[model samples]
Target: MMHKPEFISPDWPAPANVKALQTTRAGGFSTGNYASLNLGDHVKDNPLHVAHNRQSLSPFLPTEPVWLQQVHGIRVIDASTSSCIETADASFSTRKEVVCVTMTADCLPVLLCDEAGSVVAAIHAGWRSLCDGVIEATVNAMPVEAAQLMAWLGPAIGPDAFEVGGEVRAQFIAQDAQAETAFRPQGDKWLGDLYTIARQRLNTLGIHQIYGGGRCTFNEPDTFFSFRRDGDTGRMATMIWLE
Candidate 1:
């Protein structure tokens, strides 16, 4: 029996022209641990199953999304002309049919668009990328002014569950002293709030309209796939396209 995929929309007041969806682990054709709707082709899941899972998402997309070979770096690609897999953490498109997509398990997925929906972008923001300026790179790549862009944060590892070592804490602190507020001492390690860090970065960029940061992938096993919780797991996708 085939189950339908579950998706979440941003709660912020977005323009009607903008459309976005966050895929859950509920539906598709992958079996076993990948067990349906596994959109990440790079993962070790069976290639056939991954293809089927990607096909399941086609009906909901305006066009085939420009999937990037995300390398946890700060590179942003222009999806309008990109052909091959680009080593970028984010992608933006001004055309309506060129959907921007990112796959993640615990890492933050951010969808962005202008108020008029003239452009859209999808960013994969893990701690390493965030510290390296993934959010800044995406914001810079956007065609709209920072103030005119609205952002929606998708499921990620929450602060309470995202424990890290001293090196992780120092990485951000070295960039900005105020980043210390996003971390708290957990024994000899620390718990980092990726959402907060992302927000701060956006705020610094003059992007104030933000939403959807309450979900935690690591804790919500039934609804999402968490790499930290399940070592070999499928990936949920966060996608955005103009209607």
Candidate 2:
């Protein structure tokens, strides 16, 4: 019997029809640094193992997820209409059973849905994309009012583990001076908080209902894949869809 993969269901008050799944770095076939449940194919993991890992998720989802070629940009796509893997950092769907997914190791994966369960989105928020306004782009794409949206921040490099230089800090501050609060001085570097920054962004868009944070990918080796911690590593998938 196959050991089923483990998942983290978002702990939020999303409508019963809006479903979400967050994968961990466990219970698949890829071995070594990509060990077990490595869902990303571009990380140099064995192709067959990658295929099997993705296939294993089929039972839990209504359909295959629309995996994007994330480039740390702010592009958002409609998963309901996308037929091929698109180069976008975020995807949303208003239709039922159209799964939107974003893969990340240390980068923050954000899942969003409206109070009405009419739409849901998955965002790939690396520091670069976060700084560049991926969250804002996705919110803009959604037909619902920002106030109707609730966001769930997934596992990522926590503030204590994500150290960055002055340049990275500068970019975020340039957009919003309040972003400074999300960083703390660490010698010449700064420890950045992806969750805080993400919440700040969502709040700015009138989205106040936020949940799920404090899980650290970089610090949790056994449970998560962190690109910063392990250069040659797997990726965890965060997915959402309307039922």
lDDT of each: 0.89, 0.95
List per-candidate RMSD values in Å: 1.0, 0.7
Maximum-lDDT candidate: 2
Q: Over the stretch 103-170, how does candidate 2's per-residue lDDT look in tens digits?
A: 99999999999999999999999999999999999999999999999999999999999999999999
Q: Candidate 1's error at 99, in angstroms?
A: 0.5
Q: Which stretches of candidate 2 lie over 4 Å from their true place?
A: none
Question: Mind giving the per-residue lDDT tens digits that candidate 1 earns over 112-229?
Answer: 9888889999999999999989998888988789999989999999999999999999999898777999999989989999999988988889989989898999999888899999
Q: State in Å the error of residue 140, model 2.
A: 0.2
TM-score of each: 0.97, 0.99
Worst lDDT run of 10 residues, candidate 2, spans 1-10
